[model samples]
Target: MRSKYTSFTLSIALAWGVWGCAPSTGTPHPPAAVAPSVPTSAATPAASPVTSDTEAGREPPPAEGGPLPSAERAGGHEPPPSRFPEQRITLMAVGDIMVHDEQLEAARLPDGSNYDFAPFFNQVAPIFQEADWLIGNLETTLAGAELKYTGYPMFNSPDSLADTLKQLGFTALTTANNHSLDRREAGVLRTIEALDRAGIQHTGTFRDEASRNQPLLLTKDGFTLALIAYTYGTNGIPIPKGKPYLVNLIDPALIKADIARAREAGVDLVAVALHFGNEYQRQPSAAQREIAGLCIQYGADLVLGAHPHVVQPYEWKTVTLESGMSHNGLIAYSLGNFISAQRRDYKDVGVILKLTLHKGENGEASFEEAEWIPTYVHYYRKNGKRQYVIYPVSLTLAAVQQGQKDPALTKEVLNTLHRLEKEMKLHLDSLQKQEKAS
Candidate 1:
């Protein structure tokens, strides 16, 4: 019989195609440095640089100190000094935030007027707070109690979920997914409203056509980012007639246009969040790869994917556009479930993907580094009350190895933690090696 650790290694090797064998020895690396400062609650709209293709051909404004020296002319004007101060911003993204029936029941209060999800994220809150921007995929609707809160095929979670996320330092959320319209048009609108009230920025779904037309632009530490989100489909629910802008649907043409708009707006970075691929699968499907490549070619600097419910591999690619301009982009196929009731092999495993964007003194922005922290959802019962908690797999493994006793650390949970720590170390090490080779 195959050991669980062997099975775990094989599963990751199959999905990633990079890990040749498990590490022979060595303690797992510690987590990366936490973010330094808290980001603003909301990003202001940046001034547009170019309005249309006609204006796109115009030259950019001269530098503060003037033009650079001419190589042909001897003793021409000297190069100008760098004006903008160097800045770095950290962004963290996680996968599906699903609310199942059991989760809702656990959060229910005695009077039933409200739900408290604050406890669910207690362990992970500090990690998230370290990031300049923490983003996630909200896989359920917050359509209020009028819709009779439920879960599963059609999920309508309490608005308190959004509130709890905001309180825990969630900078933004991706609102496009199969369950975007679970409660129909009303649900879609209500979800946006709830997020707005909680002061959390979101994209992929809109309350009006005008809002949909605008890109979700965020500014932090002198860097501006344009975030766009799209889903493959809405679980076969027909979008209301004459309201095609309710939810963003995956289309190359539409995606290209949005990327162009972001460029015209002069945003420093363009990040695309996609809800695609087969559920429970650990590998990126053909469609997922093709679409991700297309987005990079269209001018996206990074692509964050979800909806697989299972963690997948990530890679960095350099894409050359039709105009002969080449750009480097990062593609993370899937992130799995951040927190949920699922107990399947990889279903409970997730990652907090972190990337640092550095803006040079000359106003040029690029990705400086990338890393991920593996996480696991721990479910346990205490005092006759069920609880769902998230734990960083590496830390949990360290604790277990030390023979510490804790109510939440059961034998099965410890096994899962060990498997996760090994798999994550191997996966991340492989990625680092590939990056160095490239």
Candidate 2:
């Protein structure tokens, strides 16, 4: 799964310690170096973790950790402000979150009575409460234990995953994907129910026409984001007869209408997340570009693409509207897989796309800037037990060299990370790739 930039300041990091199956110990390293508008081989820091005492739900604990401390303390007050100031809102989004059979095994305890996914995301805690809002793609189904838990071709994970996602600070997620129908209509309905129980907002697949007709508008710090999601298809799974609302299929006209309606609604921003692209392909196909462009032209401020299972190109460009007005929009073709047992080169690599958005009191908005933090999942065997952890690549390398102080072991880990980081560079900043594709 892909990740986003957390600390442009390059200093925040989550404290590290051992947890049952949660992302376990290491010296807390700063986040990855912030990747600029162009994904160059630069270095910055990443993460802001608050160690949580509680796991999502496998076992009960007192409660999760507290929020990060604010810059201001008690008795502190803001200075006098000028008129009509613009508010800067930071938005964070990650790529596909697919739990394969191996991941299920890793999350399952020795007794196997329950499954816990909190450990999988605990290491990334700094991102938990920092962003104004965060988004992730639930690329599997939480169709309940009554159904056999499986993966890959048909993914039905435990409801506990939603508890962890809620504990991890995900305000919203897009559930419309090829896996939406993995359990058919039951999967689609149960998944949303789980999200609701977790108090998380979701878009894309819907339970009925009224739900499908109503657009999903997420409000944060008074700024609203209209989230519209659709998929290319459901891996040959047929939408139940007379139940088109069960899944959102990619349709240019429908996509345009949705964006138009959101625009008309006066929301601060419109983000269309499309789960379309070839699996394991390092680059987006020509069709991906055309569809992305159409969304931008139709008034979408951002396009969050996924399903490539690898990082694809991203661009910020000026989009001219039919009314002769121009606005900047971002098209991130794919964020890649955020967390999974997919250990193949790029499949194990992903990024967190962090965007800075500015909105003036006058109601004008702008896509101020973009940054990314690369992530690599480390799946291994420890004491004959399978373990998996996601690390911010560059920062982990730095921590090992500076803190671990084990030359031989550090060298071994660094070799693996350095190679992965280099592989990430090849797929980012693809203006040249875009030109060629055109």
Candidate 3:
């Protein structure tokens, strides 16, 4: 009856690439346990002074109320007066959205038949109102009540969970994770249908070959993003013989081909979601680096990863084009759990990975800024029933200290919040040095 979360942030330029150490889907193994760190991330706080990342060597943004710079031409082109031809959009993403046994019990109606997951996400809604697109990992399957609504090892949840996500402003979600097949092929199909009824966009799992073959593209403000997702495996679940298209497993060749096709389709950006890496680990493994590096090399503009169920470091890698123009791709190895019943320290953590992406009249992608808001899940008994609420870590801590009283803000909870904020700062800061060093 406690709390959980996920998140990442990045600022980088566009380039072609793809990567993730391919985990074969032919086998199914139990997923590793996550190490909780609470909430999500400590992005610049909305309650405090605005914090911006404009490091040395990075160009200062154009003066406000003035014209912006246009895209630079290769050798023979002239410098343009302004960047007026470019369009800007915002993207926000998070880590795993999990349903545990306790949550299932908590959401069950007093009538004992229906479930209402609405109260769990209200606090986090305002923050996402302006995002051009809101994406997250739907870690559990919407396999319906006939599946008995289980959790963890074989997660199946009320279809209304998808409705809750839609109401929460989730424009899209990735479905190819270790637990994607908890109920096997039927679960995957029903999950897709639930999302459909909720009017939510999803990638990763597909019910038909044609759906698998088609690209998942999201367009807004004159820019389009092609998103592809691949999990290492379905916890060793052999993807139902002859239904290879049912779920997206990590296969470099297939990914390469997919990215190639996305590029051919002329999407403004390609974001690859990878559900790999060791659970409970805060750092990405070498194989993770290899996979991410390959994805960036294969032309992915943004690489969002998960499976660690805890926050991990992010990177902005520079890739030079044949014409010598320098561009960097974003690689957030893990965003942590978006929501879960996990009680571990860091595993309880997550962030709302936010980015400001720009597209030129020519359809080139560039990044203006990135941010994350650290969040934590707060669980407590209400009217004799257990409940959970996700709160921004720093903002809530500040309020609690300033006399905002809440029954669940125990000394232990405050202590954990302080530690999460401190650690997250140190963790995210290291990325600056990492990018600079690279």
Candidate 4:
């Protein structure tokens, strides 16, 4: 398949206060609250020169000793140092990780315990582990093994899934999806508990008021990012009496309100992870575009979506924040399935989107670049049991290159991506206009 955003460059920079902040679990504990703020040096928005291999789909070279790009100077437009600490952060986001009954059985270990999913996820571990921050969607509930772990109908996954995800460097998980309440209240509570125990942060669903309003804070490379998540509904699950706030639903009012609260909390970057749209359909529905535009109009810095179970085109757009500052943000309408039991043509593959944040010498934050890495979920049928596994495929690798030589698989994957791009091109151009106007 062809590479997306090949012109973008990925780099790691730690600009003074922008370099090393810890990922916060609940409410943010700002640096000033813990220790005295250090005087920071001016930052530069330098990125390494792009190479052919990176554009060809090979992994970008390591950042060590790589030259940093020079900061953009307006000659006289520089502003005063930003009061909020400027940070250069790198984030890696994947799509849905749905655990079906078949894959759960494959996770069965030798001892009496259930499945150990470490091996199945070994392939993409490096990519996740390598990034300063990793994010993805969890489509199944972690309500324990005694509960039947079915696939499509309703899912109650093993809590072990949380442990496996954390060990693989998944810092945050979006609990918002159509299956958020597969087992109703039990499913929601169990999933939260399991993620808590694993030390993995989660959002989109909560057990109480405190959890519901909790802000997911992560410090990577030097930037502090606040992530908020919401889903369309909980499989038609009614909001329990007196607990309407237990789960995040797809209400524009709710989303805008939550975003306002997050920004007030002093979050430098705000990311909204939304789960919407029909399954397996390549293009985003009209409803998807409308809602996404509204989100950008609000205070959202970036929006990542899932629940479509197929790769969707991403657009870099310019949005005005509540602060009245206009800046560019990346939005992936849907990432499809990072790993699942679905076995079909387009449903089998996923994309890995890499994002880098930068700060100029003026100390203002901006999105530097983004790149999409194509990946696939391999299926194996053995011992009369079918299992699903995830694999990260580089776009320009020899195997992928050779696979592209095949007219069938290559044509299908490339065609779907092209269609997605075509649908979003106008939106991207509109975003550029907004940026220029600002």
Q: Over 4 Å off in model 3, which ranges?
A: 1-85, 320-327, 360-363, 401-403, 431-438
The alpha-carbon deviation from the true structure for residue 164 of candidate 2, after best TM-score superposition, in angstroms, is 0.7
How many backbone clashes are present in model 1? 0
Each model's lDDT comes to 0.76, 0.73, 0.76, 0.66
Could you give candidate 3's per-residue lDDT for residues 1-438 as a string of tens digits? 002222333323332222211122211111111123222123222211113424322345668976443433233444455544557788899999999999988898999878899887876787778688999999999988888889878999898899898988899999999999999999999999999999999999998888888889999988789999999998877888888999999999989889888878878788999999999888889999899888877767789999998888777655543334444567889999888998775888887777777654444455545666677887788898989878778767767768999787889888988887777866855655664566
Off by over 4 Å in 1: 1-81, 399-405, 427-438
Q: Assess the local accuracy of residue 179 in candidate 3 as a C-alpha lDDT between 0 and 100.
A: 94
Poorest 10 consecutive residues of model 2 by lDDT? 13-22
Candidate 4 displacement at residue 64 in angstroms: 24
Q: After superposition, how far is residue 112 of candidate 2 from its true place, in Å?
A: 2.0
Which is the better candidate, 3 or 4, if ranked by TM-score? 3
lDDT per residue, candidate 2, 1-438, as tens digits?
123332232222221111101132332222223233322113222221112323212222323574332323345554345455546677889999999999899899789888998777755667556678899999999999998899888999988888888888888999999999999999899999999998989999999988987889988766788999999999999999999998989999999888877767778788999999888877778899889888877777789999988888776544556655554456889999899888775788888877666554444454444666678777777777777777777666666657655323345556777886676655565553555477
